[model samples]
Target: MSGTFVGMPAFPEAARGAVHNATLRANLRHATTTIRRKRAVAVAELSDWAELREAGKQIKDHTLRHLDRYLEQLEDAVTAAGGTVHWAADADEANRIVTGLVKATGETEVVKVKSMATQEIGLNEALEAAGIRAYETDLAELIVQLGDDRPSHILVPAIHRNRGEIRDIFRAEMTRWGRPAPDDLTDTPAELAEAARLHLREKFLRTKVGISGANFMVAETGTLVVVESEGNGRMCLTLPETLISVVGIEKTVPTWRDLEVFLQTLPRSSTAERMNPYTSMWTGTTDGDGPRAFHLVLLDNGRTDTLADAVGRQALRCIRCSACLNVCPVYERAGGHAYGSVYPGPIGAILSPQLRGTDSDIDASLPYASTLCGACYEVCPVAIDIPEVLVHLRERVAQGGQVTRAGTKVVLKPARGHAAERAAMRATRWALTHPGAVRAGQRLAARTRRFHPSRLPGPGKAWTATRDLPAVPPESFGDWWKRTNGGTRDERGGSR
Candidate 1:
């Protein structure tokens, strides 16, 4: 949830821990593969899924293009409909706004619907600083909270933890928060669920305020939508007197018709169902029906900065279904925690660097996490071309070691102790740009192919020490091709 990715290791360093954990790998494989297959089946059922996907993409793009206009419309509508709209420019601003909102409501505790926006802003940590207790109502989120763990997957936050591990977290940590874990708490799905249910039910009914993040907010109707599999969303949306929704600016769609596209694609892509069990929506506030007072905090938090980028702005189109995560080979082996952001896996690889910038070793490392296999692109409901973006970002990172912000580029210096890579890359780029020097060097290497060393020397010697250099042929490929097949002779022969 931290804005800065300082102290987080690069992907290779973080992934090493995940790859070594056999249980994590097994859990990732089983869960992702199952979800991938189910999602494929659900998607195949809809004949117009592609159009829906495109519409969703276009809707997000259009809204983003005229974001200032749509956002003002949203603010006007919400205010007219008896809701207050607060704008947050960054994580710190968002957190301060949320903390102030809670303090204004005179509530020390808030029951929360599963909200990724809050996670990105670290609202809970911020609230804790102000002595306001925030409770997660969604079941997986409850598991994450009670377990004192960070969310791994977006849809299923506790996907990394098996039942056994969950049982341990609940047994170990739940009591200190509010209700005690049942003495008979077991790893059995139903029992674990029951333990969480009892624990959350109390917080729901007792809390005076609720906090949430919406999947989509409709500008025309001043509506906020929350889609989920559990009944927790219903509790958070209805049970409290004052409901405060903290949502990202990018989550806005122009109208209800636009909302419907994601309603179809999101449920199928994320949970592998025809529809989520709960799709709770509200327009401002309804007296006696739900929360009597409502507030919508529209958070920018680096989004506007990201949207200014031509190639990077496409990341804003994500609906966070995380289908790409399931199909990602790197995510399967390395797991989600390695990404070090609330959003993880394929979406995280592109989205995180944009939202957080590639300043840190972790964000810089994320662009290189993929094999660029394009499996993520195949599964993405919005067709986010994640591999394309990853490579674009990798170029952004490796070339100047920096990311651009608002038409300006910022170069990043190598972290302490990684200077050798920067130097190596600089030399490589220099060698590549000068063709005459490269050709002469190549010819000499070919002439002395047998005498050429198998390993690099100097600062690079350590890199090739363990791995053998590729064998160079006696003749360069260009020379061999010229000697063996004259271009004109081959054309005359008409081999094709």
Candidate 2:
């Protein structure tokens, strides 16, 4: 996990603050609602959406099943295409590799396309710590960088900020990083975009290095694909003398044909476009076109651990389209920062715990951040079944188990505060197994119903604080069943 999110509070604690921010909630609701509606329409245009989704699922599953072989093939293909491939087992190693590469270029600054991989590894912060500057060129990313804020969405990093907030960030922060925004910048979309464009153009022309993360990597031809609405990715991909892409190993597909399914699904799922405005594909470096030196850093960062879980591994099938986020009720209210990871929303709820493990407060609480309404699964292009994974992870967190961390298997203690829950589940199992005991307990509860408190005490206080405890029936259901011959029972314990 990136050091940037170290010491983040648990989800409930973080969400409490975000949930109160009326402006942030409004921004998120408006943006996500619009995206969701547009996405639904775009998806309806596809006649074979189900087939495309299934194909994508199968492709990812097959590639993951034989990841070792496919990754080697991908490495060979990349090397054959006059590019170098570096394997990073974790975030620190990945950052070190990238920093070394940038330092080797003898350049202090690099322009970046919006790359979740880079953000996940805290590459910008790493580069800055090493005395090198990394400029984000994507409009949303530029806004995020200028505001000194974390990305709140996968596609739109600045989705939490409205136009006015963006204008303020641009006017106040742009000069600190690079070229200043116009003296009188307004909140209009066109003006904000132009200000970002003019600010980035100088970096595009002068910077010798560029960094990015790929949407997909083709093993058969060593092709990397980046789908974006902004031309910033194309500019970053082409204008630099040295191009370095840090990508997750899970992003690789077996062939270009497999890439086709995602190309269709990703844009529609993400931007609600038939296709993104700019879809950039390149095979290493060309003689006189694009960067002369190209490098691909394949980052594992606990993806291998994620792949080892049966039910949870399906999370790797995510294409980062963020359809799940747009439709997520939790994300709409609590916003992205609550997840406490580079990945946010429903996908983050499942993906972050697996990637980072459940040892930390934030990671342990992530599984419970959702309503489990299955909206995320419904919208997922690859049918990731996010709710299922979330529940599975919850189980993992509730019960101590062996988990892989940094390629080493270690036993984890059950998360704190689950002792009461575990005891209750045990009591439930015992009662269910003994019919006589359940009947006796039911009768006792019924007889003692009048003494019951509306609010519980001790560990159960939190549960009852916001909810009314159900009143126990005057008689047991079993007693009523015996009296009524299973026909019906009235509220007064009379047979009907």
lDDT of 2 by residue, 50-78 (tens): 99999999999999999999999999999
lDDT (tens digit, per residue) of candidate 1 on 180-299: 889988899999888988888888888989899999988887888999877888998898888889999998888878877888899999889999888898888886789888989899
Model 1 steric clash pairs: none
Worst 10 residues of 1 by lDDT: 487-496
| Candidate 2 accuracy as lDDT | 0.92
TM-score of every prediction relative to native: 0.91, 0.96
Candidate 1 residue runs with Cα over 4 Å from true position: 1-6, 401-440, 451-468, 481-496
